[model samples]
Target chain A: MNQPIAHASLAPATPFRTAADARRAIRSGAWTGHTVGLAPANVQGNLMILPADLAGDFLRFCQANPKPCPLLGVSEPGSRRLPALGLDLDLATDAPGYRVFEHGELTAEVPDLEAIWRDDFVTFVIGCSFSFEEALLAAGVPLRHVAEGRNVAMYTTAIPTTAAGPFHGPLVVSMRPMKAADAIRAIQITGRLPAVHGAPVHIGDPSLIGIADIAAPDFGDPVAILPDEMPVFWACGVTPQAVAMAAKPALCVTHAPGLMLITDLLNRDLAFV
Target chain B: MNQPIAHASLAPATPFRTAADARRAIRSGAWTGHTVGLAPANVQGNLMILPADLAGDFLRFCQANPKPCPLLGVSEPGSRRLPALGLDLDLATDAPGYRVFEHGELTAEVPDLEAIWRDDFVTFVIGCSFSFEEALLAAGVPLRHVAEGRNVAMYTTAIPTTAAGPFHGPLVVSMRPMKAADAIRAIQITGRLPAVHGAPVHIGDPSLIGIADIAAPDFGDPVAILPDEMPVFWACGVTPQAVAMAAKPALCVTHAPGLMLITDLLNRDLAFV
Candidate 1:
């Protein structure tokens, strides 16, 4: 298991300041760790690559469940470039790492997708919570998990996602415990960035959403919740991975958890206002 | 004491399709009740008329405490018209009723400001919760106060308003009980309308903000809270009134509670997005 990267290590001692710089470093195998705080001003996205046959249904699923799977960009069959997100973005190798799955079962983790690129592949770039986390931190709402060098605690909720074809599963949520004041501000700040899991799905209680234990999360590390803090949950981008796995597509690929596709699009561009 | 006006009576037999028509009715003394639910599509504002000598301090106060006192429009001293809010708006008589205060004590409740209009008077139109409430209702979030035909329960909070000169006091908040789901939605919906107490100041608990009892409120009527409901509070426009009274200006004027100045600006115009 990969140990959680310290928040300080998110900004590596490298000359990669722009998204293009970061992508080049990522493509050249210069950086293989999580891209949490790297390229801090630009938008980082969750990536999912599926065969052309399953792309249409996945698009519909994202449309039906936008809060979890906000589609930032979608590529045509066999395409690797997404000029809208970044002038030089190459989906096949832009992410820090890629997870290859065959029949929904993870087969290998590779630094680049060039080794097993498929002509029928279609890439979907979904908005991630990183953009809003940047917004929250900029607004002075301290994130406990990020501060403590732990992954955001994630849980499978009782709430069901709106199904589209074979893509369906219980909604997955990422949790961050915060003071009520910070939580209120977080809601307002994140609410403006709907492309990145806007606002929160649930707040205050855990069992209310079917979580049996606050200390144990279905995914990620659980951070300490102080007596004054409330556990706020946002619909996770991981939902698509869960749904895609459940669908059992012939071939599917995704960025390894916390390893995202850095884009030239500034976080401000995603803000609705 | 005047009985709470039925939501039906808010719309009279007169044709008030436009804000100008509604103002004309109020000016002609044809409408003399609460303005809630009337001219539903237009923005209704809380009215505050202060002498020129205090206008600067009041404006600073509003600037310092924006959430509780969102200043929508302010008129030149002695000007009865605010062309920005409405082409035909007359600050002197557009509202249904006015409260005259002398040294911060209410001396009279009159239908029009005509009898006491002064050359030194400066009119201020503050954004009211009614605009965001309209947005909330339009978004299908049911307001318990509206449904129960009572005023939104308001309370005084331990949160202090940033002071500008003599204007300083505890922040006033209006509470609406909603399930956690609706509360989250309300935050997103209202967060877009910052001109009118955007988003909520507090959620979940009342005592956390210094309210000793959840059953009793300092202002407005309390409504029922179901087992699933959590009380959400927004910065109330009434904060200005409380602050102004505490300051004890020589003479001040405000629209009677629930009576407001209907403006031509549509509620949609207030949405940040």
Candidate 2:
């Protein structure tokens, strides 16, 4: 799938007061595309919108499968404002892009969800990998995908998620190649942030987790796995989308992959003891 | 050296009362042997005594090398009580066994220090592995050393210790083998207890930490390392004693290998945010 499209760099004449100002610019049709490296150091969220009926099951699924679907905030039926994440936030337009799925089928990829917003829609703001990635980078952990400028490779593992009502599927995991020592440190650092898919699900041999082919993942782009490097897997935010699609919900909507809903909450504020 | 000589356990009828009662038994000719399975939940510590002149440097040494020498409580020169660790604690007689060193040379191993107590001596209580081991065992993490009835293999590694004052030497580490998943869990569990040797310093290939041979460790008996297991190494408290001996002070003292000083402080009290 094509990314939401990278946002245009600042036009050199834009005025900015806070994170909400940046979001306003993006929402005003002045900004378009992926939000990578833009307004970073803020907690970005993976978006999922579903009918109010399935909201309870999806919430349970997220609670059961915290490593993959760390819940940051959940909106009431038909609500748009996630004031906890942002003040001027409108899920329909604040995000850079959207993927509309009908009957678990990709129907369209667009810049905004305004035309498709339904009164019965309940929005879920799941934590993205950006916070942990920021932490890893701060700790000097070399991220192969970031260096190579590609999406982190993700795999559908044989590890089954705890079935919550109709929401059930194999856990999806994103892989990053790191040295063993760094992998250990990464586990400790990420463990501190349970809100962001805390700690790693698996490290070392991918075969142990039933990944038949590490070279070819089921999703995302594959990067080099060096001789001394181990493929450390984290429960990815994508797992919820995969689980939702597999269950064949009549209608579902999600953020275009990588085009997260940037929020005002600093990543550091999400730490748990 | 013959172990604490478990004569008490051979025909034991006495149920130990308090930590002080247990220490007094070990002090007076009532008991001598492994403290393990004795005071189940109490905090145990590795003991080190240095001359006042070199105590400042050793303090810096501990501050610099926190992983190996997580200093829990320190006593002033000529003072035997560490009120932070326990009530009415007398360092000279609290430990079951004491090793005396003269200018880096082993002079004697005794049950108590009453015969050699000096006015200028300063005592330090370093966090030991027993605290975390109890936690791991409580969590059902199989410990190969205790299972096989052997001492956890310890090695002097090429990983250098941060030196302060006259104490500078290679880091000494203790090895325990566990499956990859368990190793990750152990890291997370121990990482919460920094007062004890927090987390594994190095894992997987023992050679990464300069262990020439995994089968033969420099100290402690070697346990089985299963093929499915990774040898996780923790910064051992022995590193300071080894460094202290190497530094060769006029007179130094430490608790014998495994006979640690049991304190009234509970292990759970050591967990810090």
Candidate 3:
């Protein structure tokens, strides 16, 4: 099992009440760690920043693989503001941490994008599982990882993505073990929120999807599958990062794992129903 | 395995285009068989008629156990018309067949209630699984029983219904076997139609629900559960008949198994979502 990757900074003792407050704290260099429990009711998203020349192909890639890369908000070329997602949001400095990539490799981790900000960058905010997880938890669905305070277990699957341009790779999924009844209810609940990874991509036997070991995951920490529970798999937001890395663009940037961009949009609003 | 009870009449040569046409044929004595394929797009319901003295308790029982006995319409004591369910429906004669019960035992099966119709009898129309089954089939969820031309398997479960007065019995469930992905999709499809035995009551293991054998059902015909498929169970309209029999009402009437009351309400209109 992969242990959660530890970051340099520590999370603040008290969580911020609103997305603006949380983003303000992160912007002021007061909190530089993962935004796990911060602004609990707001939408927190994964970030993907690529040069304008490759933005159209990347947009097509996201449109094709919607389950893994549900586009929440997209910024204009060279723009720092995504007004639809957050009124006061600055695409460059709002996220707690950023991972800069060079030739498909992690080059450096920065607190903010001040030094690396480029005029040709286009920002894409993709929907994360946090939104649907909140809905599930609110509906009294027990989440083992949430109770254990660990990151969700994620794995690479034999399922292939509909390739667009150079962005082609195996689909990545996050797994949650649930009793059969809860799993059924989870499908109904998540099926309403197509904006947040939507419903699960696969359920039951992991081997059918080429997952050899339930105890081991390629990303995040693994949680035990209780005797009564079956592992439910959802398309992961990390797919964009993984695909970007494989594509080896000249310069690509993303929010570090668990270090997401908090948006003003209420999680409930994301549910179409 | 329980074989479906053989009725005296055969199904019509062709399905009726509308609920009105189907009910008209039944009322005029032109059709006296099962309504399975008739009025496919409309709602078909279970019938329960009891004395006015027992109607309140039966209504309460249905309200408490809505999943099994979803109330579609009710008639005033001795009134044969249920305008909301059908503009010209005559409750006493519109159904293809009726089962008359005396002291909890089936006394007779009759073509119509003309011989036993009483001034104090109240009619209760309960939603059936056929509506959700139609929705499921429309969504491309292949039902094994339908393909095999066998009745959907049904079992009496350890899961008990909430009692109201003397009305109480274990829940009766209808089973359909499907692959994990189809089962998940079926849950979502059925969850939308609460009026028609919405969603599944239980799934997976039959032993957990006190069902000792999957091959032998207490009601309906058995269909094979493929190795890749798990049995998905939904609350059956048969529960009201089971409860009514257990309660041992002095006099009770119900539609003969498979001979349901076709209603004017389209199955699509039943979806709350």
Candidate 4:
């Protein structure tokens, strides 16, 4: 999961203390790296931009599978600003990096979407697990992937997501191995934040969910599952991207994996309480 | 787990619709049976009345172990009424049945505490799992024991409770067998009711918590566990009674298992939201 050392020079000299600061840095081209540890207190969202023609069905798909695609805010067609997320935030440029998909195939990776921005584009900000991860870490529950500096292991499960139009596929889940006690605490802590993939989707035996091997994952780097720990699975934000890709949309733009759009909303604000 | 058929003759022809009605029925000589399923929409509490001298330490014990001994309301010494629980409820007679314990040994079973009420007694109303069970059932999560017409299986665990003065012992947990999906839903539903036992303390394996057999329980009748289900355990309110018994208070009083004090508070009122 180690990043290329050559890219270290583009990393920010100091970590961002707020979502606004992080977005400013990304917009100014000072930070072009993954947003994992940056703006730790604010919500970082999964970005998905599609044409207005496909927006209705995709919105229904999100409503059908809220655990994986909890819609935080949706932008009006062709609008760059999502005032609810940030007053001056530009959906096309706020994310550090963006993946351009042409007919469901990754055609290009761009630092900013200015050249490809379209008038009929609609932006959908989906809540990511990072919000609840911050909550769990704040409560002293250790996340193995975060501690080891690796991407959380994600898998494709046999569990079918509720379909809407062409958006229908198997659910994707992120795994975090923890002791039984921590797993229970994680459930309680994350259960409070329904916007961010609330609670665990499955626990204990991974085979029940159709994962053939515990050591290998379909997405992200695999981390160690200690002898005493159980792998706890949460519905992943990757589900929307995967399902959208399977449908072969003519044009779809998403934040690259590990690179998210930092929003001004605080993580605590996302908690249902 | 069946109660004597003779007791059915003493039960009300129709179940009480509210806590006030149930308490009134118990106060009168019309109801002398277990309070399960009676006043189902309200909070049912485990009653614990101890001497005034021991009240301080007992309160601390409950505060330290809120999961197992969630303190709902504490009465002023010698006070028969708890206005917060119910405006006209009498601690001495609201419960359907009570067990008189002298020096930690069960001496006699009585319908009410009027004959043995003490001037220096302090009634401690502890939250019970029945509140969360109601929430689970309302959410369409089926509870095996409730469906089978049996007691929820309970086991004494290797997990120990934090000590406060003389009160200290192993944590007792109530087990509910559920399929993976229902167990996940149950955790989220029950997690919202922290005033009750809250989310599960442990899940998946029983032996890990020192239980030798899943079929045989330390207390309450063992209900059938389906082959596809896992036993999910929650911190049982029985922990307080067990800890108090180990302390051997000179005179202690408690509601007999399954016979709880119905409180005026609605189950929805206890949700953390």
Candidate 5:
């Protein structure tokens, strides 16, 4: 059983105001946990590393399924740095925690990718929901899961991803219950930020998208939905991970859930409108 | 006992391509029916005419409740022309039909305001949902009522309007049943045209907004809501009329429902984004 390693002493005492500060702290081993509150003003990304041979199919998959796999930045094969995301970002070390997968199964969880960094590995930084979540909070839309300190309930939907080569699977969506008004507002707010999952894929009835159970999510803890609220679902970053695992890639690496790679891109800059 | 007088010979043989053309047809007695398909590319407005004594409060009410009463153009007291909407636009005779109200009660419906026009009457042209509906249809969002040749279903919600002087009443909303996905797309599409009601006020679970029965609408015709569809609601142009009626003004005039005042402004130009 590969469990995520947590370093108690590595947590930062103060939040980072800039992406560079957060990256430096992570690179120096001072911060080795989730990057949620570390850099409040920067974009955070879901990180995935695959072999050079599999990168093309994955890229095509992302193009075909933009809602689930919105590309933020991609690094050249074997490159440790992603200059577009951050000036001094180290792809191998900037992320707080990394998960190593072998033949679609979790093999090890480490603080950094230093031990098994592959020369043929290509780094893909995908957009995360944090940016839009921050926007939603700023707009006064409340998130029950965030308030309760629980992971957003995620479920595997029957909605199929546009297939590309061997990269294909059901789209996994993260659910947040909201009042009808707030849900409508959330749709508009997230619609402007297409880089971060854009708008919701489905709203209201769970059965419409093949989710047989609302209280039981396949991943993440289920938050109690109020009687006055309707469940709103967004295309999740987990889709690529789920699809990659299903493809049974020989070797794969991903940022652990909740732990992300902080980038220099401002969340506002990602809003196309 | 007065009712709208429709002249079969007054209906235009060919659809007008320009606002000027449509206004000319209406002005001349060549069009005396609904202005639904006339000047399809131009903006059409919900007409409201009130004496100078009530105009100020009505303006304030519109400002407070922009979703239901988006002001597109206004004419000064005693002025028959709204040059901003169109140089040739006549508030008195440009609309195909006008409804006269006295003490909040429907007194008479006429082809034009010529016989009842007063020097102190102030005309307010409000943005209509037709613009956003066209945009939605262009974007491939299907409208069931339009296909069935029936009026959009409307209801009076428990949502109260912000009162201004003597203007106050329950907020009236138009309901459109749509698949969750199409409803999401409608929100984004309408969000761009703020002048025309903007995004929907509520979505899913009509009872949450105090709509007890979705099938029995307070105004307009009710359409079938499919089992897989959710009822999406928007603040209706009928709201101002409802509010004004509740206020019981001495005299009020409005364009007959669906018989709008066509303007020179292109619908696309009204999109804020």
Candidate 6:
């Protein structure tokens, strides 16, 4: 989970309300710290802005591996808003932070996208694990990361993604410790929300996916694991960014890892059935 | 898909009609065969009838594992009708065949229960995997078992069911061969219908659940497997019948495997969302 900034004077009543208001505040540069726990119930997503040239591959990538890169919204080329996600969404500056890349190289960290707003930029909103995390929380599934106030332990697995042009790399997974019964029920509950990483990709043995160490993670912080619990892993949204970076695009922009775009779309809207 | 059992006497258009129509045909000995792939899209279920003394334990066993043995309808003690499944559902004579077990032993394979319908018999209609299979077929997921026109491969796993009196045994799983793409879609599609062994229990590696061989199943014939596919397993309805037979009630009876009770209820009615 992303650590959100505490703005005592501006915090909203509830987590959901706080998210909507927080995004609005971030759009205006009032609060640009982080959007992790701010709007807890609402669907928060990772952003990938690229020219129309690269979007086709990214779209294919998201469509191919929907579990990790579940697409919530895809803006028209040169458009600044994705009406499906939020009626008043401004893709360029709605997120709390942005990382600009030129030729896949890190260039600048901007609070807002006022300077590099490109007419050719197309914004793609991919579903993150946070939406399902919220769903799990609502269903009374104990989340070790949230309980311990630590980011989920994310590992780069050897399982390769379905190739979509230049977007192809090893799949990324986030680990969560859970009892067998809770794991089964969590699969049933999260299985309802296809847009939120859906059900876990792999369960039981971590070695099956090529994770050498359970205690160490490629990204995020490691939480505690009890004796009776199995570490469940879900495909992550960073997969596309990692794939895109490896692809070496001429120009790429994305939200900072922890600073996701909070959308007005209710998490419940993600359930297919 | 298995060849539809089209009776010449009945309207050829209605694949499998009312239980009365089926039983009337069966009683006259017009049609005596497997009921599966007979009723097309209608709900086909497992049938169980035990003496009144052992009804409570059997009911508890069904309740314990709703996935494998979801109780669609249960009859009053000494009654042969299940009003919930069908208005004129006569459990004593509806199914084409019945397996009679006495003292945990197979005593006879009969055409009807009229001669042996005990006054204290309690009939229970348990949900079969047929409902979800219909949904999967409707969703355009190519079923390998159905394509090969064979019974779904079922295996007994090391995973044990919650003990309810004397009825307890390892969980039984039905296998379906599917590629990653179809497997994911199958997960989402089947997850909607919880009454039909919703989703899958173990996917990818079969040995992880203690099944030494995927091809050689304990029950049901094996189907063809593709190189790009994984063997997706589901909690099979046979788990209850097998366990009940193992427990060896004083007088126990069940529908012949593959020949189930056809109910009037639509498969979609069982969907949670």
TM-score, per-candidate, Cα-based = 0.90, 0.91, 0.94, 0.91, 0.95, 0.75
lDDT of 4 by residue, A1-273 (tens): 111101010122349777888899999999988887687777888999999999999999999999999999999999999999999899999998998888888888899999999999999999988788878888999987776666778888999999999999999999999888788888878877889999899988889899999788887778788877888999988888889998889999988776788888889888752
Per-candidate DockQ versus the true complex?
0.66, 0.55, 0.60, 0.61, 0.90, 0.15
Give interface RMSD, per candidate.
Answer: 1.2, 1.5, 1.6, 1.5, 0.5, 4.9
lDDT of candidate 6 at residue A150, scale 0 to 100:
71
Lowest lDDT block of 10, candidate 6 chain B:
B1-10
Best by lDDT: 5
Off by over 4 Å in 2: A1-17, B1-14
lDDT of 2 by residue, B77-177 (tens): 99988887777788998888888888888789999999899999999999888888878877888888777667778888999998787889899898889
Error in Å for residue B233 of model 2: 1.2
Worst 10 residues of 2 chain B by lDDT: B2-11
- lDDT per residue for candidate 5 within A1-273, as digits (tens), equals 123222111122348868898888888999876787687678889988999999999999999999999999888999998898887889999988889889888988899999899898999999988889988988999988877777788898999999998899999999999999999999999999999999999999999999999999888787888999999999998888889988988999998877789999998898962
**Candidate 6 on A173-252: residue-level lDDT in tens?**
88888865566667777777888788888765687678999888887786777766777788877677888888888888
Q: Please identify model 6 stretches exceeding 4 Å from their true place.
A: A1-17, A24-30, A51-69, A74-92, A118-122, A140-187, A199-235, A243-251, B1-21, B133-186, B201-233, B246-248, B266-269
TM-score of 1: 0.90
DockQ of 5: 0.90
Cα RMSD for candidate 5?
A: 3.4
- Which stretches of model 3 miss by more than 4 angstroms? A1-14, B1-14
- Best candidate, DockQ: 5
| Model 3 lDDT at residue A214 | 84
Q: Write down the TM-score of model 5's second chain.
A: 0.94
What is residue B227's positional error in candidate 5, in angstroms? 0.7
By lDDT, the better pick of 2 and 4 is 4
Quality of candidate 1's docking, in CAPRI categories? Answer: medium
lDDT, candidate 1, A1-273, per-residue tens: 111211121342345678898998888889887786778888888889998888999999999999999999999789998899988889988888888887878788888888789888999999988788878888999988777766788888999999988999999899999888898889878877889998898988788889999899888887898877889999988788888988888789888766889998899888852
- Backbone clash count for every predicted candidate, in the order shown: 0, 3, 0, 0, 1, 0
Q: What is the lDDT of residue A215 in candidate 3?
A: 96
**lDDT by residue for model 4 (B1-273), tens:** 111101010122348878899999999968887887787778888989999999999999999999999888999999999999999999999888888888888888898888889899999999988788878888999887776666778888999999999999999999988887788788878878889989899887788898999899888778777777788999988888988887989999988766789898889889852
Who is ahead in TM-score, 4 or 6? Answer: 4
Model 3 lDDT at residue A123:
96
The count of residue-pair clashes in candidate 3 stands at 0
* TM-score, second chain, candidate 2: 0.92
Model 1: per-residue Cα lDDT over B85-142, one tens digit each: 9988999999999888888788888999888999999988999888887788888898
